[model samples]
Structures are given as structure tokens and as C-alpha cells.
Target chain A: MDEKDKEILRMMQDDFPIVPKPYKRIGDFLWMDEVSVISRVVKMMQDGKIRYVGPYFNSAKLGYSGQLMAINVPEDKIEAAANAINKYDEITHNYLRAGEPNIWFTLMTPNEKRAEEIIEAIKKELAIDEILSFKSKKTFKIKVNPA
Target chain B: MKIIDERTEKVLKEFQNNFKIETRPFKRIAVKTGLTEEEVIAIIAKAKEDGIIRRVGIGVRPALTGFGMNALTAWSVPPDKVDSFGEAAAEIQNISHCYDRECPEGWIYNIFTMIHASDREELENIIKSLSERFPECPYKVMETLKELKKTSMKYFK
Candidate 1:
């Protein structure tokens, strides 16, 4: 991606304008036609640089809750544990990290009871009870638009 | 307040992935949901205004770009310093996700920041600078070894 392409990628990170023709509006600012701009975005998407492009919702505002849960898995069992955890529809992000709590994931549920139930279920399934869940007391930042 | 009916919920679920890029994208969405283009657009607008829709924009892979080797760094902050620390941590461009998590016993960390940079060196430098800034507070940087799964949960079944 060239400088101009990067600029376009960066520009698309913001809340897309709510207009009749959103791409055309963006194209006018980029000094390119709507078709060309759309094509460029398509190319970037195919390149795997752009993971997705759609409406990112505020789940909490829409009556949902989330928590960050970390589990300490052995180096060899990491894959097995992740596979088991990922099977749940509630699991959004699961990652292998280097630390005492080797595996980490974030799960969202409709309510506090459901959240606790799911966590307990995972603990029983894995047979590792010490799962440290760190709930956000206050959120300073959440979205990170990578340029 | 905007109403969220079957129409809006359908759009939210069906278009979670593969939001087709086109000249008139909403027209395509309109056809799928059996709604007019204008109605489709209005629903999305209302969702945004209601804060249900955070934003409609591009989502890119950070590691594919210059920003690679992302890690979550935690800082030990006093009760009085959490608000101030969280505010300062949020302002940094490289430091993307920051939050004040619950402070449990045996863990001094209350402030966690997700730092992303082009390479390990850059990430290290950022951490080093942050540590230097707050010499009193000890920090722990947990490196991301592998991504087990990364996907937004589908709100609508």
C-alpha cells in the first residue's frame, strides 16, 4: 500500500458519513471518483489488511455485558484449551499470551448471571478452576483505528 | 429513541461480515432486508444515534500493517492515581486499548493498556518510555504469542 492508499485506509477508520452516497462523499475529499475509491477499498479488503468494514455496535448500550477472562494453560495444552473455549458463541477474542495466565479471552453475555454461568461451565470443561476474570471498572479507550 | 425491529436486527446479523463494497452499498443491503434504500439508511442512522451502532467504518488487521507485536501492559497505580493514569494512557496514539480493571489482591496492576507497534523494538521502547514516565509504578507486559480466535460475536441469532 502506498501513501495514498494508507491515507484512504486511515480515512475510512472514522464513522462513515450518513449520506445518500457515502462513498461518493468520501471520493470527493480524496479527489477520486466513487468507483475508483470503492475499487481501492475492495483491493485492500482482499489483501487481508482490512479485516472488515461494517457497523461496529456498542453492545453494552444495547443491553449486554463483557468481561476479560484469563486462564493459565500449560504450553502444550494451549491449543486444546483454546479450541474448547472458542467453541462457545460468547467467546469473541481468545489469545495465547506469555505469562502465568497463558491464555486470555473476552466473553460477552446478555446478563451477569449468564456471564457467570458461562465462565463456570468453561472452568468445569477445562478442569482448571483458577480463571481470573478482570472486569472493567472504567473504560478509558476501546476502539483503536490502525492506520 | 429509535425502534429496533426485525428489519434492523436482520440487517445487523446478515451484514456482520462481507459488507459488499459498492457505489450504492445501502441499496444492496436494502434488497437483502426487503426494505427501501432510504429506509435501510435511516435504520442504520438511528442505530448510530442510539449508540447501538458504534460506527460504520473499515476494520483492518493491525499486525499486517506496520503495527505489529501487540501486547497488554499493566501498571500498578494507587487508588487516587487511576483516573489520572487512565486519562493519560488513553491519549497515546500507539496505545490503542486502555482500561482500569478491578484490582484484586496479589496483583498490583489496575491500569492495563494494549500497546501496538511496528516491531518488538518499537513496542519495547513504548513500554520503556511509559515505565520511565511513572517510575513509582511497576508494570507487567504480557506479549501476545498467538491469536486463538478473533471475531465479533453475532448479536442476533
Candidate 2:
């Protein structure tokens, strides 16, 4: 990734253009051509530097409730618990961090009741109740783009 | 305002599962949704205006960009000051996601901020700076060990 690539990434931080010729807009901004811009994006994806260029939806706006839960798992069983949590599509992100209550995952459900249902199911399946769900009191920063 | 028509739902579904990575990507999505290219753009614009869709960009890995190191740092702030502190943390470039979570029993730290840095020293410095800035709030750090999954939630499924 060179300076030009960073510039492309920085531009990409904006929602990709919704136009038919989206690459053309990016090329115009960077003083390059459409082919080069599209090629670079493809390269970035191939290199594991990017997953994709897409829109980020707001769950709350879509009438869904989201929560960040930290689950207490024995080091030996962390992977199992993570696997179990990943089974549900409601769980968007799952991570293993350093510390007790180490397994972390975020859940986005259609409503508050649905959120409870998923959590209850996990509790029963995992046979654990020492879980803490951090409901969003407020969202300070919703967009954190790496450019 | 949270109403989604069949057409809008179809468009959001396309974005969730398939974000075409080609030039004239919207043209492809337009065909799938049976909307014109212009209509697709207009809907996206309206969604952006409504704050439903945050941003459009390459979903890149931060670690690849040299900001790989990440830690979930929690600060125990007075309930009333959490809002202001959260706002302050959000202003810092390194602190990406900041939130005030419910304090469970035995968990005193209520405010959490995710810090992403390239190295341990940089992350420590940010934590130190944050501590000094919010000295009243005692804090703890949990460095991220491994990423199990990092995909966006697919809605309208």
C-alpha cells in the first residue's frame, strides 16, 4: 500500500458513490483513471487489506436493538463458547480478548424481545449465566474508518 | 420513520449480502432490484440523509494499515459525567468506538472505549493520556487476543 493507495482508502472512507460510474468519481478526485481505481480496489481486496466496499446500516434505525456482551468463559472452553455464539446470525462480531469475561460478541436483533430470546438460548446452551450485556446508553462514535 | 417498504427492503438486502465490487456497481444492483440506476442512487442518498446508512467505503483491516493493536479500555466514571467523557474520547482519532455500558454487579467500570494502535507503547500512551485526562475515573485494559469474526450484520434477512 503506497501513498496513492492510502489516498484511495481515504476516499473510500466516504460511502462509495451511488452512481453508475462510481470509479470515475474516485478517479476524478485522485486525478487518475477509472481503470486504475477499480484495479486498485480489486488488489486491496485480494491482499486482505479490505473486505469490500459497502454501506453500514444503522440497526436502531431499522428498529432493531443491539448489545455488546462480554461472556465469562474458562480459557479451555473459550473457543467452544465463541463457536456457539457465532452460530446465530444475530451475532455480528465475536472476539477473544485478554482477561476474565474474555469472550466478547455483539448481537443485533429485530427487537428487545428477540434480543432476550437469543441471550436466553445462549445461556441455556452454554450453561452459563455470568454474562454481561452492555446496552448502548449512547453511541459516541458510529463511524471509525481506517485510512 | 423506521418504516421500510418492499422496494427499500430489497435494496438494503442487496447492500447487506452483495455489494458489487465493480465499476458501475449500482447499475448491477439496479438490475437486481428492478430500479433504475438513478433510482438506486436517490434511495441511497435518502438513506444517508436519514442517517440509516453511515458511510460507503472499502471495509479494510486496520491491522493491515499498521494500527493492528487494539484494547478494550474501561473507565469507571461518575454516572453523570459519562456522557461528556464519552464525547471527549470519541474526538480522539485512536479511540474508535466509545460507549457507556450498563455496570453489572462486581463490574465497576461503566464506560468503555476501544483503542486501536500500531504498537503497545502507542496504545499505552493513549491510555495514559486518557487516564490523566480523566483521573477521577479508574480504568482497566483488556488487549484483544484474537478476532473470531468481524463481519457486518446482515439485516432484512
Candidate 3:
């Protein structure tokens, strides 16, 4: 990404306005047209520089209960397992990490009961014996951006 | 841009509740709020600029999409190096969330990094590199098991 692209990414990573004409507002700030801003964002997504674009809502306030889920899947089956897990809309993000329980993902539901229901579904579908769910007791820090 | 009027407040609250999947949904909201579509657009623009609303988009849970592995790696660094260390940690792509927290007695982990990966091995490799990069500091890995909350702030209330 060039300097201009980096600037665009930086603006995107920070707070993106929730207005209907968000692209236009961004264009106004950057002295570019709304179409150009939209095109750049689309290109960034296509190039894999960004995963997706949209509002990063506060799920907690909406009464959704989520947890960090981890499991140990055989290295060979990691891809397959991840694919199966990704199929669920409730599963927002999944990651591969280096640790005892390598497969990590997040699950969100309208409530704790629903969240557990989704977890049970995964266990049954994946046939995994060991799974760890870490629920946050307190939020120490939660922000997404480059400092 | 006027401090959100009562009608605008009602509209925003509804927007948070009913984020339907359809084109020109804002028009529907405008209909409900008794405002023109252009007014609805303008209010959202002003609220966002004022930092009252962060974004109007999807909220995804990272683990379910195959980015499953994540851990909070804490590092004990000299007071002089904390700022630079945080800057370096923030540059790592996989390290999404980084911050400084007050360390408890006998546990001086002031610098924390949030590392996400597809598996544990990958996460460990990143931590190893981080450890090597900052050999003088001691670190610990705290994995997250549950996410109690994952939403942005809404100041419309």
C-alpha cells in the first residue's frame, strides 16, 4: 500500500462514521470524491489489505453474550474444522494460534443460553472432546486500531 | 448537526435495534422517524463526527471464522522502554489490541499484547519472536475463554 492507501486504511481502522453517506463524509475530509473513497475501500478489501468494512457495534450493549472458545484439533484437520466452524453466523472470528489449544474462535448470541446452544452444536458437529470457553468477567481493555 | 433532537434520538435507537438486511434501509428509518432521508443521513453524519456513534456495520466474532486462537501476552518492561515497546507491539498485524494495565504486586506485566492466530503453534511462534525482540522483559500468555461483551459504545441514551 502506498502512503495514500495507508492513510485511507488508517482512517478506516479508526472510528468510521455511521452516517448513511459515510463515504461522502470521508471524501469531504480527505478532499476526494465519494466514489473515489468507495473505490479505494473496495480495492483494499479485494487486495486483502482489509477483511471487511462496516460498523463495529458494541455487542454487549445489545444484550449479546459472547466468549472466547479454544480447542485442540489435529494439525491435519485444522483447516477442515475451521471451515465447519466458520459456517455459523454466530461465530464472528476464528484464529489459529501457537499454544496448547491452538484453534481459537469467538461466539456471540443474543443471550448466554443461546450462546451455549451454539457451543453445544459445535461440539456435536465437530466431535471434539476437549474445548475451553473463557468468558470475560471484566473488560480491562477493548479497542481496535493502530497506535 | 444540532444536538440530537427527540426524533433523531428515536431514530438512532431504532437503527441500533433493527439493522435489517435490505437496500436503502435508511429510507425506512426516515419514514419511521418522520424525517426526510437526507435529514436522517445528516444526523448520522453529525453523531459519528461527534464520536457519539462509532460505526454502523457488522459485528463479527473472530474465533468462529477460523481466527480461533488468541491470548493476552503480558510483558514486564523497564519503565523507560514501555512507550517504544508498545509502539513496536502495535505494528504487528496479528496483534490487534494492545494496552498498558496496572501491574499487581509481584506481577509486573504492564505491557500487554493481544495475539490472534489459526492455531496455538502460530501464536507461540509470534510470541517467541516478540520474546526474542525484547529479551530483557519477562512475559506471560493469558488465553481468552469467553467474550462477555463485544459491542461498541452508543451514546444516544
Candidate 4:
């Protein structure tokens, strides 16, 4: 990505226009044409640099409870556990980190009861004994501005 | 207030991630939601104003942008020191996400911060700077071995 592309990314992260011609607004700000701005964004998306340009909805305000969960799955059962965890649409991020709790995932359910039910079901199916769930007591910062 | 009418649901489902990246993008969303471009813009604006939509923006991968080295650095702060720890960690720009999480049984790490840097040495330095502030609390860096599944949450589906 060139400097112009980086500039576009920096601006978009802070404030992406919500109007009909959002790209034009960005182009005007960056001193580039609308077509050039759109093409560059498209190229970045195709190159896997930019995931997508979309709205990030607040799941909490949408009445969803979120939790961070870590499970200590045996090496032999890692694949099975991952497959099982990925089946649930409610689980947004599932990762294999280097630690005792090898498998970590984030769960967002419509309510706390639903989240518990899913966790219980996973434990029963996989026979997982060592697990930990960390619910956010307070959020100090959550900003993504990478260019 | 939470406003999830039928039309709003349709709009969200269509443009959550698959937003059109062209001129008059909202027009396409309007077509999908059976509303005019103006109505679609109004819906998004209201959602943003209501704190339901955090931002209409792009998700840039730090790995591709030379900030690939990232990990969840969980700190074992004392019960009384979590608030101060969070405030101190929040001031640093490298720490994108810092939160006070509920500490369950068998785990002592109560505060988690996602630290990102261009290299391992840089990451260690960032950790060192933070640890200097609270020498009493220990920390652990759980490096990500692999991403099993990472995707945006699809609501109103």
C-alpha cells in the first residue's frame, strides 16, 4: 500500500462517511478523485489488507451478552473441539493460542442464560473440565486504527 | 432505544459486511431493503447516533501493515489495583484493547490488554514499559498460534 492508501485507511478508521457518496467525500478530503479512491479500496480488500468497509454494531446495545472463554483441550482433541466450537454462530472469534488453555474463543449470545447454555452444551459434548470465562467488567479502550 | 424493525433488519443483514464499495453505495443497500437511498442513510445515521453502530469503517489487518506481532497480554493485577492498571494501560497507543475482566477460579489474570507491535523486540519493550508501572502485578503473554475462526457477528439473521 502506498502513502495515499494509508492516508485513506487512517481517515476511514476515524470517520467513514455515511452519506450516499461516501467515497466521494473521502476523495475530496484526500485530494483524489472518487473513482481512484474506490479503486484503491477495492484493491486493498482484494489483497486482504482491508477486511471490509461496514458498520460495527454494538452487540451489547443490541441486547447481547459477550464473554471471553478459554478451554484446555488435549492435543488429540483439538480439532474436534474446534469443529464443535465453530458450529455455533454465536461464537465470533475462536483461536488456538500458545498457553495451557490452548483453545480460546469469544461468545456473544442474546442473553446470559443462552451463553451459559451453549457453554454447558460444549462442556458436556467434549468432556472439557478445565475452562475459564472472563466477562468484561469495564472497558478502558477499544480502538482499531491500523494502517 | 433498540430499534430493530423489519426494514432495519433487512438493511443490516445486507450490509453488515458485504457493503457495496462504490459511489452511491447506500443506494444499493436501499434497493435490498426496499427503501430509498435517503431512508437508508437516515437509518444508519440514527443507529450511529444511538450508539448501536460504533462506526462505518474498514477493518485493517495489522499483520499486513507491519504491526503483525500481536498477542493478548493478560496481567494478574491485584483486586484493588485493576482500575489503576486499566487506566495506565489505556493511555498507551500500542495497547488497543484494555479491559478489566472477571477473574474466575484457577486463573489470576484479571486484566487483559491486546498489545501489538511490528516485531517481538518492540512488543517486549512495550510490555516492559507497562510492567514498570505496576511491578507488583505479574503478566503473561499468550501468543496466538493460529486463528481457528474469526468473523464478525451476524445479528438479526
Indicate the worst ten consecutive residues by lDDT in candidate 1 chain A.
A138-147
lDDT of 3 by residue, A30-92 (tens): 888777777776676566556544445455554556666768787888777777777766786
DockQ of each: 0.70, 0.74, 0.10, 0.74
Q: Give the residue spans of candidate 1 off by over 4 A.
A: B1-7, B14-18
Cα lDDT of model 3 by residue, B25-103, tens digit: 5677788788887887777776566655556443334564346777877688787877777877877877876666554
Report how far off residue B27 is in candidate 3 (Å): 6.4
Clashes of 3: 52
lDDT of 1 by residue, B52-151 (tens): 8888887778888778788988899888888878888887888878888886557788898988888899888988877777788888889888889988
Q: Least lDDT summed over 10 consecutive residues: which range in candidate 1 chain B?
A: B11-20
Interface RMSD of 1: 2.1
Error of 2 at A101 (Å): 1.4
Of models 1 and 4, which has the larger lDDT?
A: 4
TM-score of chain B of 4: 0.91
- Report the C-alpha displacement of residue A135, candidate 3, in angstroms: 0.6
RMSD in angstroms between candidate 4 and the native structure over all alpha carbons = 1.9
Q: What tens digits encode model 2's per-residue C-alpha lDDT throughout A11-128?
A: 8886677777988998999999999998988998999988767888877888777788988887888778988889888998888988877888899888788888888888988998
Better of 1 and 4 by TM-score: 4
Per-residue error for A17 in candidate 2, Å, reads 2.2
Give per-model CA RMSD. 2.1, 1.5, 8.3, 1.9
Top TM-score prediction, candidate number: 2
Clashes of each: 0, 2, 52, 0
